[model samples]
Target chain A: MTAKTTDRDRDWAAALAAANAGDARAYARFLHAVMPVLRGVIRARGRSFGPDQQEDILQEVLLAIHAKRHTWDPAAPVAPWLYAIARYKVVDAFRRRGAAVHLPIEDFAEGLAAPEADPTAARDSAALIGQLDPRSAEIVRAVSLAGESTAEVGARMEMSEGAVRVALHRAIQRMARFAKGERG
Target chain B: MRTEDLIAELAASGPAAPALTPRGTGLRMLAAVALAAGLFLMLAGTRADLAARLAEPLILTKTLLPAMLAAIALPLGLRMMRPGARIGRAALWFALPASLAVLLWAATFARTAPAVRFADVTAFALSECVGLIIAIAALPMVFALRLMRAGAATRPRLAGALTGLGIAGLAATGYSLFCTQDNPLFYLTWYGAAIAAVSAAAAALGARWLAF
Candidate 1:
């Protein structure tokens, strides 16, 4: 949209158009020209990521550009299309990392003191489990509430680890419904 | 893994790639359309009324209209093969002939009573005519898509649809040779539907195969 963007698009479009016509050197030049632009775009978009993650995103955008090179329309502005691909790669990286909730340790330092476990909370968890099928309830208690590994729960229940995990997931869902005062 | 290495690899791989051009691709599409027409004529001879209909402006318009559509669409399809390229609003020009055909059909309908119009529109060979045109378009559709894949079609679905429209229009033009029905209403309804069908099918195929 800006004059700067228009210039970049025009440059890229011309370079890529030449590249598609079997000009290897032009293709290299196009790639070289795009690399820094893509890196900057990725860095700005994924500011939450570290240097390594940003590099990974940059590489992803590069690979995507390579794989989808033939999909670019030579007559259109190249920068917007290239940046759109970069944005998608960044989003994919974010999705792959899931979500991280960060807090400064300085603010939580006073709260780090050990506190007594609440019996009512434990009792409430138990009551929630009591609403599930007996087998599922036990799996949830072991794998979730009791902090037992899935392998340990599986071994104790004589079920495959995957089966135990599945049962536990269902039990947790039912427990969530119960907590929300909804019938599961 | 490094950007320089990636660029070097891409550059190195370039020699094996053929030098492609929009003009060359456009010519190939024309060849495909011609081939489809040749095959259709060889397989299904011209209609019994063809010699007589050749002199009629209205009958000649049926084939000419589609030929015009194909001519317009060919360049548009070629344009779509490149990344960043778009089939401009100029493509709307194709609709002109189609609109005229519809108008001509309306005029015919008014002149000819409802019963005669119904008889012409519901001709027994209607489905077969549509099917034959679609069948003729199939091979050209493949050729067009292959040509398109060789280029960078950023909007694959649109590119494919345009290819289909262009190729199918040509195929319909060829089918017009064997079709005895001279009524614009029949051509508008059946030919229009057949072109739409081919375009839709091409769009679907392009979405799956053409997208990177």
Candidate 2:
């Protein structure tokens, strides 16, 4: 693009080289640089899922990206790699509390197998459900899991957006409670 | 605000990009040719001044070439061979220059050292091989910062790191031909350590160059 853009590109290339070679400080710089993208993915997806816990998903995604970066080949463009990371984080959000298709036991099990199964995830999910009032869980399932947009879910549930928003908010709270295995 | 401005703002608010990737068998062949030329220069120079004459091409390749090449080329070549591992778009625009700066660092090492000898044309390359590796590793951190500021996005940190290491390894071979003196340990340890430090700094900085 502009000369400044070109210069930036060149420098980015160098940072990657350093980080790949195993520089902690360089990796930190790398992390700082990309925080915006992480935030974007979280915010964009959070609008639908409710922003209450978007930051949590973003953190998970970052950890995953950091932990699993060695598999990437150098010759390829990094966008797809990042997209893949974001996609997983978004899916994780859906699974945790957002509107998501409650997969059959077998299907969910299979999904769990692909990313090292965390016995604690299921435990956490159950715990979050415990804290939520019954009404909240139903709203969460319908809005976050049942593939219904907030408006659509609201209309189907015969409630105003305000009501839907309130219910969803409570449901997300329960989900967060489950995730942390804490009522607080 | 206008929709365009909102979109721009949103886009700017997103994670940075990290562009990374490589070439073909013919290109590999070209590298091989370059390696050969570099080797010739290095070996010729190493032998140019031995009273006892440790400068033998076959020996050089056996002891220094393979280790140096493995240390450098295997990583770089594999990256060339496997392009799918990186998430290239995540790097910031400024990062590109930052990497250039790192790569450029290798060239500076080529300047005449304390002992510029006739054989240095060849033997000196040993040092260069190590230097190049240092440059490759160091480039990404600086590159990423520059790219992030310029607004490039990146992800897949491991990919960037591997590629950086691989590139450093390859460049090191060429560099080793020029920089390596009679001491193998010196190149492996001292030079290697220096390179590692610089590379670590580069990557740490480059991480920012990529989008999250």
- lDDT by residue (B90-182, candidate 2, tens digit) is 334325433443443444345536464233434446445544545433443333233223222233244334334433444444444444354
Best by lDDT: 1
Span of 10 residues, lowest total lDDT, candidate 2 chain A: A98-107
lDDT of 2 at B164: 42
Best by DockQ: 1
Q: For model 2, report DockQ.
A: 0.02
Judged by TM-score, which candidate is best?
1
The RMSD of every model to the true structure, in order and in angstroms, is 10.2, 16.9
- Model 2 Cα lDDT, one tens digit per residue, A60-162: 6666555445434454444555566667556656665534223222334554675456565444444555566776766765654454565666677787856
Cα lDDT, model 2, residue B61:
36
> Model 2, stretches more than 4 Å misplaced?
A1-83, A87-184, B1-21, B24-156
